[model samples]
Target: MLSDYFPSVGGQRAPDAELGATLRDFVAQQQGPISAHLRHRHTQTNEIGRCVALWPVLAHIAQESGGAALALLDVGSSAGLNLGVDAYTLCYHCGGASVHVGGAPRTDCRCCVASCVGSAARSMGCANLPVAGALSHRLGLDPMPVDVRDTDATRWLQACVWPCDLVRQQRLALALELARQHGWQVKQTGPSCIEAIHAWLDGLPSAVQPVVLNSWVLCYFSEQERARHEQAMIDLVRQRGVVWVSAETPSLRPTDMALPATPPHDSKGATLWCQVSHHAGEVRQRALAWSHPHGAWLQWLG
Candidate 1:
């Protein structure tokens, strides 16, 4: 269904065609580190430039909620390693053989083309800003989380990574270690994960704004499941919560960005870091992105 909707990695169902023969072999083997390395290697995220692009909008969520202490959730958060985004002071290591991290978020301005959804998100009045402070509170949720601590799980995580990019693998390792150092753990378990999240939400003192984001989750869901989960989200929204979700377009119908709309395919270059606040069925979208990561450009599609 995802392939029918939009182009997946290389748009090929088979392994060799998408990432090459090595990946196909690795996936079939299903070894531990190899899977993780493959996943980290090919599945993006190591592109710190892209992730940092929307720091500010995320920061805005913090400001709106209260401070650096708002609950953050990442749906389909593979290894759940990136959930510890706050621990590492990200630095873009692009155009280099090794990851060139920085002690802090880069301070530079860059340009990016807005996606159709991004344009609409801007129309909704979202503003992007660099926010190290807000990132401190981010968290994650994934169905088959890669157990970074378990040797086998780590191996599986690496194996799923694209076979070619060792840099990505190393970057993931570093990020996982950093997250672990911070006492942030991602669990591998049941449907109650959502329930646990709701419980966490319920536990919050309400002084902070609770935000839920599930980027690229629709691809994994069947039509029925998508309907059910989306309804759940709607119920959450009705309860006055904030949700940040973006799925590749061609995979979904193009509609108002304010409503539950699929993002456009080929909408590259820019990201929509929007905040939605609905008023009597009328919602406003906030478009924001960091624009740059210490000189290197980034695409933050929050």
Candidate 2:
């Protein structure tokens, strides 16, 4: 991790040091083992921050569907952190700006830490609805799912965090705790995972609505694979009406993918949000809002 070599701007071993040079020197030392490290380390950052923007859309869907229990299938869910989305509380500040804070940043620190915040709330229709008992079945699908109980795996997940961000780190700790308490399972996903999902959905009672979610996962797939997966979901919707939510980077999601015009951006960078429903061979897409990939904050356009 480049962050390990990064010295904080101030109050560090190398005060007034050039950041670029320090990073270069560290990279030089890590030259030969970079590939080996990459093979072992999955950049599977389960950005719990993303839930700030995701939860509202989820709640809205559940509420609109007559408050029916939901079966949430999270693809590329490393360690299943977001599977516990209903466990946490959200605090909205100044309309679009929402934050989720829990526990102390450090054992010695007394102040509460706000981990994730959306950039802006362009629309006010988003309500902080109750999440309790909203989810009946939670399935985490990943090619490689980390075992939260394994100390090594858990440590690696924490190491993936930006070295300087203690607030985010603390939030990760809390999310892990919640995941364990909730007993969320991380399962292997393959080409057959979709078929397995269909089987699972078929067995569920008519009352339970199915919701499929994935954040920054399709980028791992080739363009052809992504297209196939997208088509499969579209087909599935026609068979049984389902909800799909995705958060992707600009390269993967074109501005015109859902909406015709370009969306607005915040300080973090460009992220594209899409919510869709396909039924009776007709596909309807809602351009929810542009959000930070890590859910730092979001501008709610839905």
Candidate 3:
């Protein structure tokens, strides 16, 4: 149905009037199917483009650990495409300079692009950014996990993407294919991200540093839930020595968390990238960067 309506997915391009009429007619004819879909499906976009923003942060983590193996746990990971972050090629443009990471020759990986914005763009050096190494283990936790191998689920993921955004559609296709080839594990867990963390953290190998990550997921939780999630993350950091990385709206972030010295020029429509960790007895949170919700651009604060 999506492919039939959107030209980007091989649908015929129609005039505005024709398109509206056709959509209305289709909806009228497919009322039952549409109703069933609406009742069961949730907006679960697995935006692989966000991996561009994640790459540098993971690299920084690896560098901090002296290149030790790291395990990744992604909360609300729909189809777990971003788990294969190291499998894609990330191209970043900053201050008229560019840097590429991941995807060796003959890999046939899709390229995800991003740019550095604002004052940070001028000072940021592509040379100093650490390269993200291979992840030791990648696990995803979601209340309702989408399986990339499932035809219906995969189609729904495609539908979640904006019809006009052909670039994102292509990226998602390539990412889905990569996910199928890799067969990353995504466990169906409870609704609370905190519960998922507690359930999975103890099972990871002690030798590998655990990095719990979530992108644009905390907003789904209530203010109280968010606070509990934050406290849980801090507890994990203090007791289990894990790192928490988040890419969410600033307003959604815990009030107790530290703010960046220089905030983004425009916070509206921007996602805040943060890293929370505990060393000794104190817990610290640092706002790493501010980025587009879909990784179009990033303003570094680290």
Candidate 4:
């Protein structure tokens, strides 16, 4: 279906008139199937481009932990593609200075290049970015987990991408291939994300540190639910020594988390990267950077 409509997937341009007619005819013939699919599946982009913004934060956490192996728990992980964060290469270019992370060779890797902006870009250099460390385990929590092994599930994941986004489509394909090779694990979660985290925490090895990650997920929750989730993160940091990494909108930031003196000028549609941890018995929250929702660029704040 995608191949018939999208030129990037089809290898030939489809005339606008024919495209509309074909779609209408197809919909009329397959109304039942289309409706069933829409009713059962939610849009799950599973964008791996987010890893460009995420790698720096993960590296920061690893460095703070004395290079301890991390056990990643990704909430709302669509196909668990971002679980292969350690496998891709990230190249950051800020004011003519460039830095690279990940073990994959440039040619054979799912490589992403991001630019930096704002006054903070002046001091940004290679030394400022921490090298990512090892991952002891990877797990995802989603109400409906997409299995890469399932043809229908993977196809639905592809259909979720915008037809015009060729770059993202190619990147997603690479990430899906990597996921199939790695066999990432995704567990079904109940209504409470905090409860799901608690269950997974007990099962992790003591030597590895637990890092909970959520990107653009809290927006789906109600106001009360968002507040509850924020409070739960603070409590987890103080009690269980867990770290919470979030990439969400500025409006969704926790009440106690201090904002930067001068927020990013281009923050209108940007995602705020943040880390919540405990230091000297106090729950500390730091705003790390401002980035494009799909990580096209980043403005380093910390």
**Best TM-score among the predictions, by candidate number:** 3
* Per-residue lDDT over 1-302 for candidate 2, one digit per residue giving the tens place of the 0 to 100 score: 34544332223343235667867777789877776778778776888777766776676677657788888888888998888776655544433423221211111211111233232222232233334337888888887888888887887788788767667777787788667766798787675357767876887788888888878888888888787777777666667777887777755553236442443334345456677776457777766655566665555555
TM-score of each: 0.60, 0.77, 0.85, 0.83
Which should have the higher lDDT, number 2 or number 3? 3
Clash number for candidate 4: 0
Instruction: Give model 1's clash tally.
Output: 34
Question: Candidate 2 regions off by >4 Å?
Answer: 1-35, 95-133, 254-256, 260-268, 279-281
In order of listing, the candidates' clash counts read 34, 7, 0, 0
Better of 1 and 4 by lDDT: 4
True-vs-predicted CA distance for residue 144, candidate 1, Å: 1.2
Model 3 CA deviation exceeding 4 Å by range: 1-5, 12-15, 98-125, 258-267
Candidate with more favorable, higher lDDT: 3 or 4: 4
TM-score of candidate 3 to 2 decimals: 0.85
| Residue ranges of candidate 4 with Cα displaced over 4 Å | 1-5, 11-23, 98-128, 261-268
N/CA/C clash count, model 2? 7
lDDT, residue 189, model 2: 68
Query: Tens digits of per-residue lDDT for model 4 on 105-223?
Result: 12211223442211112232444566667888889998778888888988888888887777777777777777887788988887766888998899988899889998888888889
Instruction: Sort every candidate by lDDT, greatest first.
Output: 4, 3, 2, 1
> lDDT (CA) for every model shown?
0.46, 0.66, 0.74, 0.75
- Candidate 1 C-alpha lDDT tens digits along 185-211: 554446434675676577666555666
